[model samples]
Target: MEMVYANRMTMQTIKSSTQDQNPPTSPGDQHSDSGVVKDTMAKRSTLSETVNQLQTNYSSLKAERDELLTNYSSLKAERDELLTNYSSLKAERDELLRQLGSKVEICEDLFALQIFISMFHNFWIGLTDSNEEGTWKWVNGTTLTT
Candidate 1:
């Protein structure tokens, strides 16, 4: 009888130890899992918000770039027009200068011809502004301004 009682006590202790080691899942564990899920959802929401903001900024920048491109094209057209006008004016001026040179050569009076040539030379010098170097200036007297 004594050995049997000892065996029964040992079995009861083993059962209690196993029950303590493997407890049943409780509502608390469920709440902990829910907290983790909430954290993951929040992180995803933040990432999605950042992505949306970046998309908006990209669209805004694209619009600005398009506007700048349009303005650049307009300015380029204007510059081309100005260059054409300048070329036309230069051609007309050259023709006028050639005609004036031929007329000056045909003058009969030597004194009058000399006076006319001197006046023409003075006018040419004044137009070119040889004394002032026009608008071009150099930092070290090398004159690189164009």
Candidate 2:
């Protein structure tokens, strides 16, 4: 039986005892005083039971609260660690992008130099003449075309 139901039943019994009171109590009627004493003892026992249940409930709740605190702290630490790792990875990605951009600039410079070399070589070929027909050659005796 639930504690609340048991308590209510006990309360009803006490009320009945009170309602059946004797109108005039003679000193010889030791029964009336004994009845009152028994009712009081029953109330005290019920109250004691209620108090013990409340204490037990409190202890259970307190332990649950401690477990929640432990879980919260662990989760907080994990979140911090994840944030740190994310920030570091972001920084590393930015660094890699910066390096790639620098390399692209260097490659562009080298490409421009190669284009200039080809243009100068063409100019020299234009300025020079073919010693014989159908033979295109450079000043360095390298054959320019077939």
Question: Candidate 2 lDDT, tens digit per residue, 29-143?
Answer: 5565776887899999999999999999999999999999999999999999999999999788778979865221122255775776765543222324468676766556667
TM-score of 2: 0.48
| Local accuracy by lDDT, each model | 0.70, 0.72
What TM-score would each prediction reach against the true structure? Answer: 0.52, 0.48
Best candidate, lDDT-wise?
2
* Candidate number with greatest TM-score: 1
lDDT of 1 by residue, 38-122 (tens): 7899999999999999999999999999999999999999999999999999788778978876331344466876887876754
